[model samples]
Target: MEGECIHIRRLTEGSMSYGNFYWEFIKTNTPVIVTGVSIKWECSNWLLKHGQENNIYSSEINFDYLKQQIGDRLVVVTKCSTHDESTVSVEMQFHEFLNYWRNQILSSKADVNNVTAPKILYLKDWHLKAQLPNYEFYKVPQYFASDWLNEYLEEHKLDDYRFVYMGPKNSWTPLHIDVFGSYSWSTNIYGRKKWILLPPGEQFKLLGPRGSLPCNIKEEMLIEKSVNFLIIYQHENETLFVPSGWYHQVLNVTDTISVNHNWFNGTNIKYIWCNITENLRKVMNEILEFRQYVNFKEDCQQILKCNFGLNISDFLEILCFIANSRLTLYMKRYRSKDMSGNRKSVNSHPDNFHIHYDLKSINMLSKFIAQDKIVFNCSTLYDRCMNLIDITQEIFLER
Candidate 1:
């Protein structure tokens, strides 16, 4: 089913504190739209001049400025009209894509009877921050500051989840969940986007033969199948928080540019763990004939990594790092206690509750990991997981 009505809450930038946002929206797995949030970001210069109207700033992307900064850089663009999935992705210079964008814009304004539909090209997943280290365009808002996935990736010098997406009108992404079932936030720097979000577990209703999700969902398909979904219209300088396990499709209502990130932290780490374990079980079942082999478990882990982008070891490492980091903060707070038979208040740290929540979640995950036969067989990994749990427990005791 499709086009079912579900309300998406709207909030202003200053309406709620980070803690409130986490408990109300994040823990509840609700989507929200925040306005007036990205208006002052350095990236906004791409969208607006020095004026405002009806609380909505109006301007298109500054193509000349963008070209000056990254015109010659190579970028990946997807041809939405291509029938062959294998050849859909093509690499080209940014300026060349801009030329295509100009043509698409012109075609959008041309008489329908006289003009042919332009090739809908979408430039997505550009790692702009990694490509230009000194180009600081925007800061992560406080509500999304607990991003553990990108933190681990950046620490290990791996690729980041931060991305810039640009496309002309009607360019869209197919319905899909975020990688690793992490939460994501997308902020429009210019133009507008229409988002159709299917809530957790509702995507199963839209599955086709062989259990594949449809490439392009059609209104007629909603007659037989049934699903509850929300439609969100995101405007320039507005950010959308998409919770874990939500399947979503985004279409550019106008020519658009946006920044997005996929991340997970304590708030939804259990969901992340569950997703990994479920995928691992599927992988093992698919290759059941190889179970007798000595390296079957390891091979499965690698295959999971190949398909899902992370495996058991990677999960444990992330857990250990986050556990240690939170424990260190806890210890520093503990040491700051007064010697006059009274302890210093830990509430001085704005994120005290968040830090404790992270440690607790990590500890819980570690206990689960310790019980897994595959992880228990690896001595080094087993010790690391156990030690992390113990450290988190000690920190809780001290608190």
Candidate 2:
């Protein structure tokens, strides 16, 4: 099957209100390149140096400053090679990677396209926020503050979805979806990146006969197949919002530093629920012979976590936390309603809209999952979720 090309919209900071953004991009599940939003971020100022290249101003990350801050910290580095699927990774101190980065830069400068031995090392998924809690690098923009995954993780002091990625030119990640089918936003602190993004479901077409997807996509393949995708050149200080389930491949066009987070909110919670259920089905099928065991459901949940990083119980806890929090806001807002018999559209209050929208979305998923006895086997949690949903509807919907 032939596919058409896709164009991603670009928006300036303050160009559109959060309401319009939520509807146009979030609700519609579209990709967008948002500029000017990260210009004033602290990291943008302190960690980068202003320079002019080809008569255009640009920001480059300061290697010296980065080393001073966290050079001794441990980091994971992936070694990528040209046309290779067996990428090896190692854990080393940050300073070691920096030394490698410096050497690679010098080598590339000497021979831009013909370097015989180039080290394509990428440092990714560094939990910088967890390590330096007091350091205020960049604040989460209001438009993305409804991140349930990070909010729950932060509140429980477990872990965060936020990450810092640094890689030299020629480093790239293969085509894949984000964890739990969550929406992801990546902001470039410095340098440029080339992103190849395919809309949801298009990736399945690229799968091989045995259900294996290529680790690295070839330019010839995209040309022969006429695959529909957006080729975005993300410049410095720009943020890219990738909607849920979108398959993307990122290559560092220049040595780049970026912060990325994977999160899901009411806008994409259905995708998260779908991902969990699909994985649950696969787990059950893999262990079909043991289905009659008394601990069958528990065993499935355990294996689900081991394989997919989340299970039914973990999902239910997240749902309850989000549902109860939204219910509290709804009740608080209900108490503050105008006493003069005046009412307004839900859209008039962004917070109120979020409360109502998130609660309704959560309730829909919770209700559906509650009926699945094989996966959602916890009776106590089910009752609590249903009670919360009932209270949410009674308190918010009536108004």
lDDT of all predictions, in order shown?
0.81, 0.79
Instruction: Kindly list the per-residue Cα lDDT of model 1 for residues 1-399, writing each as its tens digit.
Output: 354668888899868776677778887989999887787788877653646888845576677788876658889999876332232889999999988887766666775674565678899988988888678887787677889999888888799899999998878887779999999999998888999888888878888789888766654464356678788899888899999999887888889999999999987888888889889999999999999999898899999999999998898888888887776776777455431211132223335665677877787888987887767888977998889888888755664
For candidate 2, report its TM-score: 0.92
**lDDT of candidate 1 at residue 42, scale 0 to 100:** 82
Model 2 ranges with Cα > 4 A deviation: 46-55, 338-349, 373-378
The residue-by-residue lDDT of candidate 2 on 232-300, one tens digit each, is: 999887889999988888999989888889999987887798898899899989999998999887898
Q: Which candidate has the top score in TM-score?
A: 2
How does model 1 score by TM-score?
Answer: 0.91
Candidate 2 local lDDT, residue 257: 86
Clash pairs for candidate 2: none
Quality of model 1 by C-alpha lDDT:
0.81
For candidate 2, which ten residues in a row score worst on lDDT? 338-347
